[model samples]
Target: MRPLIGVTTYREPARWSVWDQGAALVPESYVEAVERAGATAVLLPPQADAGRLVGVLDGLLLAGGADLDPARYGADPHPRTGAPQGARDTWEFDLLAAALGAGVPVLGVCRGMQLLNVALGGDLVQHLPDGSHQDPPARFVKTEVRTVGGSRIAAILGEDTQVNCYHHQAVARLGDGLRATARSADGVVEAVETDGPGFVVGVQWHPETDLSDLRLFEALVSAGKKG
Candidate 1:
């Protein structure tokens, strides 16, 4: 049987046809990527009982979304910071704790990576100095990042790779037990991972949007099998 993977989602006003109302949704590309990687993908909306749901999942994917509340890391919001999604923040934190405790395979993308950092006692830069990560609004741009030798990212993507990026915030202070695995030319952290038996990796890029490469998703699914 294919491993079951749950991808986090956004809860906000959305429109389709004549209906405009609150919806729990994620990008179709995320689902497509998980499917292509040979896992069963499920959307995880913010819920109080999300931690309990992790019991049935072989893997948990923290999908990219809105900015996290700066309060999470004991910092005031930057002028460029967007409003926080309180429900999603609380839910994902609980869900992440449960997943990590259960030794489930986990992957984080873009905003997801930021959340992972903040959850583990780290912080974010709020906004990049040059803002080159996102060239245009609502579109991904190509950015080159080099992975540290012997890191999991390097093992999968080799020493360097071009990734699709659309994030303004980057990892500022690394979280507890996590180590930087990849970085860009500007010295911004691009990827992070923990030293443990579980598969926990986070990347500051939208790998799902870049269908040309499925190594990250594939790696998560492969780890899910062992999980």
Candidate 2:
């Protein structure tokens, strides 16, 4: 059976066609990327019992979304920081903790990466000036990231690679048991990984937006299969 990968999603007020209501949604790119990586993609919306699902899932994906509540890391919000989705923040945090506890493979993107850092007793930069990590609103900026020697990111994406970036906040201080594996030209932490047995990796880029390379997802699925 294909490994089941549970992806966290955004619960927000959405508008489509003539209908406008609160919904739990994630970009199709994330689902497609997971499916293309040879795994079964499952959307995990915010819930009181999200942690219970971790045991049955082969892997957990913390999909990119809104900025985390600064309170999570014991810091005041930056002036330029986006509004926080408190419920989603709490839900994803629980899911991440549960997945790690279960020793399941986990892949975190953009905001997901930041949350992982915060969850692991780290902090964030909060707000980056224009042209630092991101270009403009709704635009993806391309940048090259150099991977650490013998790191999981280096294994999948190689020592040097170009990636799609779209975030202002970044990992300021790495979490416990996590090591920085990749960095951009501006010195922002681009990727992090744990030395533990489980496959726990986080990247500041949006791999789902670039389907040309599915190695990252494939690696996650492969790790899930092993779990």
Candidate 3:
């Protein structure tokens, strides 16, 4: 059987045709990336049963979304910080905790990366100065990230790679048991990985948006197969 990869999604107000309502949504790019990497994609809506959900999945993929509420990391909101989606934040955090406890292979993208940092007791920079990590009007800015030697990111994307980024916040402190594995030219944390096995990794950029490499998702699937 193809490894089942559960991807966290956004629960937000959306519009479809004439109908406007709240829904669980994730960009199709994520699903395509997972499928391209030879895994079955499953969308996981925000809920309270993350522990239960993680038990059956072979891997977890935390898709990008809104900024986390700063309170999660013991800081007040920054004026430029995007509004938080409390339900999504709570659900994804629970999922990450459960997945980590279960030793599942996990990948976090963009906001998902920030969430991982905060969940592990690390704080964020809130808003990057002078739009270093993002361009104005929420556009994805292309930037190059240098990976650490012998790190997982380096192993996958080589030493230097161009990525698509669209965030104003970044990991400001190293999370417990995690280390920075990549950085942009401006010195923002671009990627992080846990010290042990099972492919626990996070990237500040959107690999799905890049579409040039499926190695990251492929690594997640390979790890999922080992379980």
Q: What is each predicted model's overall lDDT from 0 to 1?
A: 0.91, 0.92, 0.91
lDDT of 3: 0.91
RMSD of each: 0.9, 0.9, 1.1
Q: Any residue pairs clashing in model 3, and if so which?
A: none
RMSD of 2: 0.9
lDDT of 1 at 210: 74
Candidate 1, 33-121: lDDT as tens digits = 99999999989999877667999999999999899999999999999899989999999999999998888888999888898899999
Candidate 2 lDDT over residue span 1-227, tens digit each = 99999999988889999999999999999999999999999999998887679989999999998999999999998898888888899999999999988898999999988889999999999888777767776889898999999988998999899999999889998999999999998899999999956799999999999898999999999999998
Residue runs of model 1 more than 4 Å from their true location after superposition? none
Error of 2 at 118 (Å): 0.6
Error of 1 at 126 (Å): 0.8
Which sequence of candidate numbers ranks them by lDDT, best first?
2, 1, 3
Winner on lDDT between 2 and 3 is 2
As a whole number from 0 to 100, the lDDT of residue 166 in candidate 3 is 87
The TM-score obtained by model 1 is 0.98
- Quickly count the clashes in candidate 3: 0
Give candidate 3's TM-score. 0.97
For candidate 3, write residues 1-227 as lDDT tens digits. Answer: 99999999888889999999998889999999999999999999987789999999999999988899999999999998888788888899999999999999999999889989989889999888766777877688899999999999899989999999988889999788889999999899999999866689999999998556898999999999998
TM for every model, in the order presented, reads: 0.98, 0.98, 0.97
**How many clashes show up per model?**
0, 0, 0
